[model samples]
Each structure stands twice: as C-alpha cells, then as structure tokens.
Target: MNLSVSLASGEPIYQQIKEQIKRQILSGELREGELLPSIRHLAADLNISVITTKRAYDELEQEGLVASVAGKGTFVTEKNKEAIREVKLRQLEEQVRSLAAESRMLGLSKQDVIGLFDLFFGEGRH
Candidate 1:
C-alpha cells in the first residue's frame, strides 16, 4: 500500500492517512483479507508517530474496513465492501453539494455548471 501525507493540508495527518487508505480500499487497490503493515512499521515508513498510525488504524477498524487478529496483525475485512460503497457514495454526494453551493455563491447558473461538467466529462462517456 502506498500513501502520502500532506503536511500542508490543514486536516490532521491521521485523517489524511485514514482517508487515503479508505480510498484505496474503495478503488479495489487493496483487496479483502490483505494484510496491512503493522502500526510500528507504517509509522516508521511514513516518518510519523506510531500513535498517529494507530489512531488511523483504529478508526478504520471501527468503520469495519479492517480487523485485527490476536498475535497476527490487521487485515482488510471482507464485510467492508458494501459499507465502503455506501461511505464513498455519501462522500461524493457531499462534495457535489458543496461544489453546487459554491457555484451558486459565485453567481454561476445551473446551466453554467452543467456546461462545465459536460465540457470536462462528455468526451469520456459513450
């Protein structure tokens, strides 16, 4: 698994790590039952505190994306498929809502937004 933390981002580092891992899982880049790097190892690799990595992993476990096995390590959970899909869809909807609000605040009409979207995405569609 590959992850990059943006120290420049105002969001907390742990949150950045969590979101990136979640995105990877949702994108199928990380499969069910995949073993995650140990918290200490990941911390070392990222040059961050172990506690921070542990917090991210803990939140992931709470979200059912990963589970820990005694004496072994944490592995991506199979049951996260549906939950992850729901989470991603909700996140996308929230982003669209924010963008729509911003467009309105900027005095852009609905048609303007639609036109921009089409200009960017139309060629990719069949």
Candidate 2:
C-alpha cells in the first residue's frame, strides 16, 4: 500500500491516510480480499503513530470498505458499485456547482458552458 501524507495540506494525518486507502479501494487498485499491510508496519513506514493508522483503518471498516480479521489483518471488502458511483457522482456534482457559480460570475451563458464541455469531451479530451 503506497501512501503519503503532507503536513502542509491542512488535513489531519489520519484523514489523509483514510482517503488514500479509500481511493485505492474505489479505484480497484486494492482488490477485495487483498490483505493490507499490518498497522504497525504502515505506522512505521509512514512515520505516523500506530493510533493514527488504526483510526484510519477503523473508519474504513465502519464504512464497509474493509474488514479486519482477528488473527490476520485488514483486507479490502468487495466493493459496492452503487456506493462507489454515488461517491464519484457527488464529487462531479460539486465540481459542476463550482463551474456554474464561476460561469455566472463571468457572465457566461448556459450554452457557453455546454459548448465548452462538449468541445472538451467531444474531442476526446479528459
């Protein structure tokens, strides 16, 4: 599990860890049943406290993104596609909201925004 935290990002280290792991799971980089690195190992590798790492893992577990075994370790759970889709959709919606606000401030019309969106995606550009 490759992860990093930036002290300057203004987010808590545990939240950073949780978000990174969630991204990996959602992106399918970490498959279901794949064992995560031990908490102690991850803490050592990241130079973070074991408590921080455990908190991240615990949140992920509570969110149904992972499961912890008593004798083994944490493992990614079978992802719920609807849940994943909802997450991505919410992010996109927020982006659109910001775009709409900025567009209105710039005196751009709805058609103008649509044209730009079409121009970008219609040309196969991400």
Residue 86, candidate 2: Cα error in Å is 1.4
Which has the greatest TM-score?
2
Q: Across residues 1-126, which tens digit of lDDT does each residue of candidate 2 receive? A: 799999899999999999999999988899999999999999999999999999999999998899999999999988888877887898799999999999999999999999998888767545
Candidate 2 colliding pairs, count: 0
RMSD of each: 2.3, 2.3
lDDT of 1 by residue, 1-126 (tens): 999898889999999999999888888899999999999999999999999999999999999999999889999999655787789789989999999999999999999999998899867678
lDDT of 2 at 49: 98
